[model samples]
Target chain A: MADWLSPAEWEAVRLSLRVAFWATLFTLPLGVFVAFALARWRFPGREALNILVHLPLIMPPVVTGYLLLLAFGARGPIGGFLDSAFGFTFAFRWTGAALASGVMAFPFMVRAVRLSIEAVDPRLEQAAATLGASRPWVFLTVTLPLILPGIIAGTVLAFAKGMGEFGATITFVSNIPGETRTIPLAIDLLLETPGGERAAARLAGLSILLAALALVLSEWVSRRVAARVGGR
Target chain B: MLEVSLRHAFAGFTLDAQFRAPPGVTVLFGRSGSGKTTIVNAVAGLLSPDEGRIASGDWVLLDTDRGVRLRPHRRRLGYIFQEGRLFPHLTVRQNLAYGTWFAPKGAPREDMGRVVEMLGIGPLLHRRPAALSGGEKQRVAIGRALLSAPRLILADEPLAALDEARKAEILPYFERLRDEVSVPILYVSHSASEVARLATTVVAIEGGRVIAQGPAAEVLGDPAILPAGAREAGAVLTARVAAHHDDGLTELDAGGIPLFLPRVALAPGSLLRVRIAAHDVILSRERPEGLSALNILPGRVQDVRPGDGPGAIVALDTAAGRVLARITRRSAEALGLRAGMDVHAVVKTVSVAAADIGTSGAG
Candidate 1:
């Protein structure tokens, strides 16, 4: 697969896959937590929490990246405190690209998962409780397994979205070749350079193929999980 | 014994009910929108009543005055829902074992082998709930609740979702549960036949209030307290199987009167509770000649409760404990049917359906 493209183009593809994988991996637990809270719980400021989670989806990707930079830049308070106290930094780093991608994809993941969680009948949970299961135990044994198909669908969708993320990644971490220039960034660079149309076309085709493959894989997995959980 | 007194008001509806149920199967008998499910939920701690106290013997589950309320998990009640509520992700075996996983340690647990045998779910244990029929799912649900070692079981129309064939398939298992298991059951249902067959104690509720409460026989026999215009109004009789004739007939002794019916499927000497519908019984001033009815009992009229319509319900003190005859007011007056009047209660042998007969192991 690498031999088919220029070294720079191959590097972009690898970096995109890595960033998307990490983003999905890191955000799954939090995504499930937020989704469950939104689907099942009621408390003060619940609407505010919902809006906050969805703000990135409604706002332009560049604005979300700028917001992330303002909060997590090297000179920013949180960024400075983290660098001084823990020797950690996210400014212009590959991790910052992943953070941007995760934020961009977070709402999509939460929406899919929350719909599935809401579809679960609460009467089953009540039945579990009356049979001596505690609230947490009920979630672990009953609610979790029932909502697993939706989680899988959500995670795969977020991963696919992360793979194609460009506006947020480029704005947050810039278009460095190895550090953060993912497939979309490489395509953008190839399109702008003089006499670069051929290379640009190849990279663009690769991105489309990869994205389509991710979508197909996600659909296959969700279908299988649904069949297993739905028992027919 | 379980004592429940609860009051909860919903939009356009209010529930204020109080009743004491004995250790046997206490049925919450009412119509749809009659707050039977709400009462069950409150007792299970699934819903909180505005002002109420629920206790199972000494254990106080909820007491609004004292500010004591137990969560559903801590209440140790087993609930069987109308749809069975089996976890779709799990196999039949896993669903049955779910409650056992949460059952407190060192408590007397129901043996898994016995439960599997009783519910006859051994074959389906390896299969998922989706593969089972409605009757099979309910049986598994009952098994799951039983293995929880619950203080009491709450069944909210467990068989209501099934067809007549499935209901017939599951009713005996419930009868077995009532006779064998020591745990009390609070069953909610709207079917008169179900109530007549299962309830040892019947608590009749209407419009969110308990209109009547007593032994099943007392509450079911009197048509005046029965649900208005209930066509299934009947009387329950305790009888022992006396003989099984070769011509496909079984003879039962109801308080020393030979009551013959088309063959019942129980061994001789086994106690049976038979529900005789009032419409099936006829009254005559004297011992009437055969005219096709097989059973005739000599009894005096106990009470004649006249209805607004042409019908009158006459309660009788017959050898079968208590029998009721729904006769027309004109016939009742023409025969001078009153308290202390001697009459022969005639019942057609074929009108006594096999579905109305229930066997009790305790008797």
Candidate 2:
């Protein structure tokens, strides 16, 4: 495999893996919280909140990137506030690429986790409460353990989506070597350059391998968690 | 001890109940949807009642009038749901220990070894609750409750989800808890037989209201209160095994009457409480001879109450406390069965099955 791919192809492969890792890591906790809220809570503007969480999936990838730019760009209101408060910037940076990837993958994560949370029996929480577990304890002990399979599945889905995220990442954070240039962006660049067919092919192969690995990991983790919880 | 007086209205039903029980097994007996579980939940601080006051011993769990309400975990009460409700991910030992994790540090810990032994769950300690049989799960659930060292245990139809064989398998453990454990228990059930076997006090509920509350014997024996009493009203008698005859019979000394039962393994001097259904009893003006029934006790009719249908229930005051006999109106009139009338009550020895006889302390 090393002989088949050039040095640039390998760098692209490494960059894609890093971007996917960071994207999934950044979104996991927020995804879980949003999934739980959507599954278990009823509040004002709940429907609207749900729609907003899922909007990235329905809208075109380029449109989602534009919206992210307006809200999260360095000069935008939220971006300006975050930049002033935390001295952090996302525009045209690797962090911006990760944010775009995460936004593109978020719907998949939330849907998977939410479905699992809904599948869990609420009676178990009530039982925990009767056994002297407070609300947080019950959630940590009962709810979290029961929905672990879903968490794993959602993570894998988000990670795979992040690895292949193209339109949003390219639109939000322009491709830059050793910065925001992920494998999909490299593949797009190679496809556009003359005599870059071999590099694009190698990048495509790496993407396929990573996607397969993610699928297998998801299945393995889900089964392990299911066994731990006595689920079939 | 528990004192609960509560009123709550749901969408279409209202629950109004008031009762007090001493330190023993007080059963909340009622049909489905009669709000028995609701009352227990209120006492456990799981549900907030619109108007109520609940006290276990000296601690006030809930007092709506004073705007006092304790959280469920803080109430120091153990609850056993119908389904056992053991944590699926935890082993039986872990599940049992889980209760103690939140219990007050200085509170007395009930003997864990004794509880495990009593419930016969020693072999299941390392296994998950899902791996155990229905009976074993319930036993573990009971042990978990006991290990918490609760001030009072509230069981909401703990046997309602089990089969008959499993029910029988777990009842003796409950009996042991009632007799040996110092903590009071509020047992919920709709089965008369379960109440007869387990309860020291019976609180009958119907249509979300408590209809009667008293000693198990009085509550079960009263013909006017229970529908079962009108058709099958009977008195529970406490008797000691006197002797066992070779011909598949055991003679018990129930007060002055020699109550004969089918062969049982109980040793002589062992105490038993027998429930003789009123329908199985026969009333005669004089002692009849050559009858198939083996139990013939001579007593005087204490009260003759007419039932709704075509029968009358005669309360008999024998030397063995009070016994109820349900006789047809025709037979009652023919025998001049009335209060203060002398009569002989005949009970078929075989009709009183072994299942109807429960062994308890020397009552």
Candidate 3:
């Protein structure tokens, strides 16, 4: 698959897949937890948390990236604490690109998960509780399995969004060939350079194909899991 | 005994009820919007009343005075919902074992094989809940609840969602649960036939208040507490399925008198509860010769309660059991019927709808 593309183009594709995979993997647990809290809990600041989580979706991607940079930049409080304490950083690094992609995709994942969680009949949870399953057990044994398809769909959406993330990634960790450049970032560079349109078009096509593949794979997986749980 | 005293007020309704139900099928019999479901939910710890005290014999589940309220899971009650809320994602086998899987370490688990056989759901073990019929779903729900090793079982009109045939199919399982299982059940129902068939203790509720509470026979035979008045009043009699004749007639011995009703699919000598509707009974001054009715129970009238309507309810101490006959006030006056009058109560064989017959809860 890499032989046909220029080394630079191939790197872009590889980097994008890695970033998206990491982004999706890291976003899932937090997304599910937040979605469940928003759907089923009645805590204070819930609406505020909801608005904050959704702000990225409504805000300009560059603005969200700027916000991320201020909080996670090398000299930033959280970044300085992390660098001094944990000795890790997300400033202009590949991790920063992944982090930007995750922030951009967080709301989409949460929305899908929250919708599915709300769709679950509370009576079923009540039934599980009456059958001697505590809250966490009810979630693990009933609610989680019931909402598997939704979680998968949300994951795939996040992954696809991650692959194409350009504005946030560029603003947070500027485009570098290997360090932070992904499919869209590489395509942007190729479009602007002298006689690089062909390579850019190829990369664009690759992004579309990858996204389509992710969607098809997620659909197939969701259907199979749904059938097991009798969701249909 | 399960003791409940709860008071909850809603926008336009209030529920203030108190009752002590002995260990059996204690049915909260009432019409819709009468707080039957609310009472059960309170007992199950699903709903917290404004103030209430609930105890299962020595185990105090909730007491607002002490600020003690156990969570629904910690209360260990099996609640069978009217809609059969089986886990849709689970196969029949998984749904049946779901409760038992979480049953506390020391809680006696109901045998999975026994539950599967009891509900006749072996063939459906691999199927999802969506594929089961309404009756089949309810049966599985019952199994799911029983296998939970619940300290108490709460059924909120478990059969209300089914059609007549489906209700009949599931009624026997509840009867078996009442008789065979040692756990007490708190059942809620608006149907008089279901209350008559299964309730060992009946608490009649109206407008969120328990108008009457006593043994099934006592509460069900009272016309005043009966929601539909005298029309819905019926007497429950314990009978033995004496024999099944070739002519599709099952002979049942109620007390010492033999009653020939439509054939019931029970082995001879099995316990059966026959609910004789008061309106279906005709009181005669003497045994009439060549009468076509299959049952002529000879008994003296205990008392006659005249209603504002032209109808009167005559309580009789027949050899079979305590039978009730609904005769017109004019008929009572014409026959000079009184407390000591000897009257033969005649019941037609076909008048007993098959739905009125149920398995006896004698245990």
Candidate 4:
């Protein structure tokens, strides 16, 4: 894998893939949960939860990364608790990059999933309840299957967004080789130096190829789910 | 028996109703906004009423005074909606099995093959709901509801969305369920003919109140309590197929008295319930010798009830059953028709449409 590209470029690509994969995989479940609650459940603090879930999307990505650092830094409350209780820290680490990407990608995934949940007919759920299924079983057997295509779409969007995440990842975990230096950060570094345009162009092309592949994969998966569940 | 008493207040309407449905098909009959669906929803726990005590047999479903309320899933009622809300993502086979998964493990298992054969939906098991016709979807909906092994069945105008042919197609299956299965049903409908064909007991709703409640024969025999007055009044008569003539006439023995109608397709000895509209019959004092009407039921008038208009509904206790005749007050005055007068009720042979005839019990 290192024969075609320089070692530094290869390291950046590998780290970016690792960060995006873990970020998207971890956020999928929580994204779906928040989406279902926002679309269906009504309680005293529902709107407050809605605004909280969407806060990162509306705020600037650099500000979001700073807030993450404040809450999860080594001396921060949560970071210090983890350092004493679990002996772990996320500051200036690859894990911090993943967390930053996931936070930046949360709203995209949730909004897609929420729209699908809202499109489902509540009467069908009522019919299921009358057939003797409890609320959770009704969601598992009927509602979940129907919204699968949307979930897949949201997952792919979050993954792509994570791969291109520059502002938050660079802000939270300072650029470093083989750890925090993802594709976008590496491209920024290469462009700032003289006689590094060729390396930067190759990395930029790789970014386009990776994003296009993600979209194609997403389309294929969503098509399969739609065929399984769509009435059309 | 299923007992329901509920009170609900809407913006401009108030629904206060009470009725007891014995084992059979009990129809909630009324106009569109008379709160028939509201009562059914309350019984199914779809909507919470302001105050209510709903019970089926000894099993209490809802009691506001006792602070006891069961959710819809725990109640185990099978509801058939007007639109036949089958899950579009599931095949017909899975839709039928969905309820069985949630049904009690030791409960009586409804035979899938029997229900499949009954509704003739075996061929459609692999197809999605989007591929089914309106009638076919409803047939599967009925099969799905039955396979749930429900304690009670609630049908909210299950046939209202279909055409006349489809209604005719589904009515027999409902009759089959009522006769073959002992589960009590609360059926909602505004069609007088549907009530005439399906109901064993009738509870007529008007202005969110139960105006009358009794056996189907007794309620349907009275024209004044009918929602549409004389225009929609009809009598349901139980009869037996006596013979089929070569001249395209089917003769029925109505309580040991032979009555003729257009050719019925049933074989001899088949029990049938037929609805005779009140406006279709004419009354005469003396036996008319040269009359073309084939049905001449000789019975003494039980009573004559005058309507709000110039018409009158005469309740006649024929040997067949209670029959109603809608006639003008001028004609009643001219004929001097009164109680205890023996008169021949004349009925046209073609007046009984094919939609009005239904088989009585299990085939």
Task: List candidate 3 stretches off by more than 4 Å.
Answer: B242-246, B286-290, B302-312, B327-342, B361-363
Between candidates 2 and 3, the one scoring higher on lDDT is 3
DockQ score of the complex predicted as candidate 1 = 0.83
Stronger candidate by DockQ (3 vs 4) = 4
> Which runs of model 2 end up more than 4 angstroms from their true locations?
A1-4, B227-232
Please write out the lDDT profile of model 1 over residues B264-296, one tens digit for every residue: 989998999888888899999978975788899
Regions of candidate 4 where Cα sits further than 4 Å from its true position: none
Model 4: C-alpha RMSD to truth? 2.0
Q: In candidate 1 chain B, where is summed lDDT lowest over 10 consecutive residues? A: B223-232
Quote the RMSD, in angstroms, for model 1. Answer: 2.0
Error of 1 at A82 (Å): 3.5
**For residues B104-161, could you state the per-residue lDDT of candidate 3 as single tens digits?**
8898777889888988999998889989899999999999999989888999999998
CAPRI class of candidate 4:
medium
In order, the Cα lDDT scores of the candidates are 0.89, 0.85, 0.90, 0.90
lDDT of 2 at B160: 88
> What shift in Å separates residue B7 of candidate 2 from its native position after superposition?
0.9
Single out the weakest 10-residue window by summed lDDT for candidate 4 chain A: A223-232
- Show the lowest summed lDDT stretch of 10 residues, model 4 chain B: B354-363
Q: Model 1's CAPRI class?
A: high
Model 2, chain A: how large is the TM-score?
Answer: 0.95
Q: Write the per-residue lDDT of candidate 4 for residues B231-264, one digit (tens) a residue.
A: 8899998999999999999999999889898888
